[model samples]
Target: MASITASYPWTTAPLIAGAPMRLISGPSLVHAISAAGGIGFLAAGTDVSTLSENLSAFKSLLSTSPIPGAPSDVLPIGVGFILWGADLKLAVKALSELPEPPAAVWLFAPSSSEELGSWANGIRSATKNKSKIWVQASCVADAIEAIKVANPDVFVIQGADAGGHGRYASAGLISLVPELIDAVREYYGNLNGGGDTSSFPSPPKFVAAGGIADERGVNAILALGADGAALGTRFLAAEEAVIRKGYQDAVLKAEDGGNNTIRTDVYDKLRGTIGWPEGYGGRGVINLSYVDAIKGVSFEENEKLYKVAEGAGDKGWEEGNARMTTYAGTAVGLVKKVAKAGDIVRELRGQRI
Candidate 1:
C-alpha cells in the first residue's frame, strides 16, 4: 500500500499520525506513537519558553531509552508549531541547536504563504538536514496556495470536525481531501503545460486530519485519497498524553457520536487567547462554562466561575465543573478508555483496541 513514509522518514504503512495537541501532546506521547510504527509530532506551539527543556528531555529519552520499533537512529519524531502564535526565528534557532533535530517540522495557521516559505527556508538553511516540512490547511484554496508558494513536503488537510483551532468555515474531510487531491493534480497539470503527464510531479503528500478516531475512519480517509490520517481527540485519553484525568474522563464520557461537541471561541476568549487570526475556532466538549458563555453570561461572571473551578483543582475536572477546557472533536464518543499511546496508534492502524 502507498504510504507517506515514501516521502517522509516513517517506516509505517497506512500512516496514522498523532496530532500536535498543545499541552496535551508531549515527548512521551510522540515517542509512543513513533515507536508503534506511526509518526508523532511534539506540540511546540505554546509556551515557547519551555522549548529547550522539552527538546532536551526528548533527546535524553531517545538516547537512553530508545523506542523499540522506531526506525534505526532516526529519532522518528517531529515538532509542530502554531505559526501565528510562535516566533519562527527563535523556534528555528532552538531546534537547530538541538542535539538531535526532529524528523520533520509541522507548521499550521500561517498568516500567509510567504510566511510558510520563510519558515521552511529557515529550517532548510539552519539544519542543512533532510527533515521534512509539513503544513496544515483547512480548505482547497489554502492547500493550493501552500502547494504553489511554500511547496511543503506534506499537506495536512484538517476537516471542520477536528478538535482544537481550525478554520471557521472548514469543510469535512470527505469532501476536502478529494478536493485537495484534485486541486494538487490540477496545479501540477497546469505547471506541466496543461497535459504533460510525463513531467507531472508528486511532491506534497496529503494527510487527513480532524475527527478520525478509529480504524474505520482511517480506512475511509485513505479510500478518499489521503495518504494517511492524523488524529487528535482519539489520543486525548492516551496514557502518555499530558492531560488531567478529569479531561480524559470527559472525552471518554462524551461518546455521543459527534453530538456532544461544539465548535466555538468561548474558551479561547475566556482564557484571553486574543489575536488568533480570524476565521479560526476550537471544537471541544460542551460543559457548564461553555453553556453559561452561550447564555450570554458576562466575561466577569464567567471569569469568576472559572476561578472557582480553577481553585477546585483536580476536583473541578473530576466533578465536570468545566473549570478547564476539554478540547475534543466529534470523535470523542469513539474513544472509550485511557490506553497507552502506542496502543492507541496500533488500534487506529487496525489493531484491536
Candidate 2:
C-alpha cells in the first residue's frame, strides 16, 4: 500500500485559525489548503472536465510537497462528491486513475437509506482499504438511515443556515447538530439496535456544518460533542472558490446586520440543474429577481416571472430580471475578503479557541 498522511484537526493547531479553518474540498482549492496544512477536498459535481483536470493538478501539487512521515509530517488531501447528483461510474473511475488515492471521501445530499451503504461498498471494492466516508445528513431520519447502511466514518449535520440547497425551511445548525447527536446516542445506543448495551459499537462521530464562520462556532460545536466542524458559507468567499467575482464581491460587501439571506427555489430553476428535491431551498443574499418573484409575488405569479427570467439569458441578474440565481448561505454577511484557500485554512487552524 502507498503511504498516506494523517489528518491534522484544526482544533490542534496553535492560533486555531477561526475564520479560515473550514476545509476546501475540491480539486480547485486543494493547492491552497494542502499548502496550509489544512484539509482540502475535491468537489466532484457534474462537471467531469473540471474534475479530471483538478484531480491531476492536485496530484502534481502533492508530488512536489514533502511526504508525511518521510522527514516531513504532511497530510494527503481529501475528496468530496454530491452523492445524489454525482456520476457513480465517474467517481469509481476517479478512484482508479488518480496518482494518489484520496485521504477521505465526503458524500453530499444523499437521500436513500441504502445509498450510503452502496457507496461505501463501491469505494471499498475499488480501493480494497478502509477508506473513510463522510455523509451529509439533513435530518435525524436521514442520519439514521445513512448510519444504518453506509455507516460512514463521519456524519455532517447540515443546518438550514447552509448556503447550498438543504432541507425545507426546517432546522438550523444551532439546533440540528445537538439534536442529531442526541438522536444517534438514543436510538443507536439502546432502542432497536442494541438498547444501550447492545453488541454493536456506536455510530461514527458527528460533525457540525452550516453557518460555522469562526472559531467561536467551532468551539460551540466541539462543546456540543461534534468531533469536528465543516463549513460551506465560510469557504465560499475564498479566492480559490469557483464562484464568480461579482458574487464574491457581493459577499464581501455585506455585514451581519439582519436576515438578508433567504432560501428559495430560484437558482436551480435558473441553472436548470436537476434532481433537487422539493421542500428544500437554497439560502443566499436575496437578489432583485428572488425578491420580486419569490418574496413579493404569489406562488403562481412568481412561477410565471421565473420562467420569463429564464428565457432572458445572461442579462438576468444584472438587469433585475433573473437569468442565474446567486447561490450563497447566510454567513455571507460575516464574510468580507476573498483570501487564498490556504489563508482561510490557516485562519481556522490557527484560531485562539
Q: Top TM-score: which candidate number?
A: 1
TM-scores for every predicted model = 0.94, 0.80
Instruction: Give candidates' CA RMSD values in order.
Output: 2.1, 5.2
lDDT tens digits, residue span 1-353, model 1: 23477644454778888888898888888878888878888898855667777877777777777765554524578888888778877887887776457778888888777887787888766556556788898988897888776777888999999998998898899899999888887887788789954455555788899879989999999999998899999889889999988788878888684677888898898778876788889888888888898888998999889878878866666544765778889888889988998888888878786
Give a tens-digit lDDT track for model 2, residues 1-353: 11112234322332121112222345556656655655566666544345667667766766776434221222255567666666777777767665446656777665455666777778766555435677778788888787778777677777787776778755877778888888877766665555653344445667677777766667777777677666767777777776655555666765662377777776566556668655667776776657766455665666576667556644444444533465666766777777776677666654431
Residue 293 lDDT, candidate 2, scale 0-100? 65
RMSD score of candidate 1 (Å)? 2.1
In angstroms, give how far residue 172 of model 2 lies from its true place: 1.8
Assess candidate 2 and give its lDDT: 0.62
Clashing pairs in 1: 255-333
Clashes of each: 1, 23
lDDT (0-100) at residue 56 of candidate 1? Answer: 76
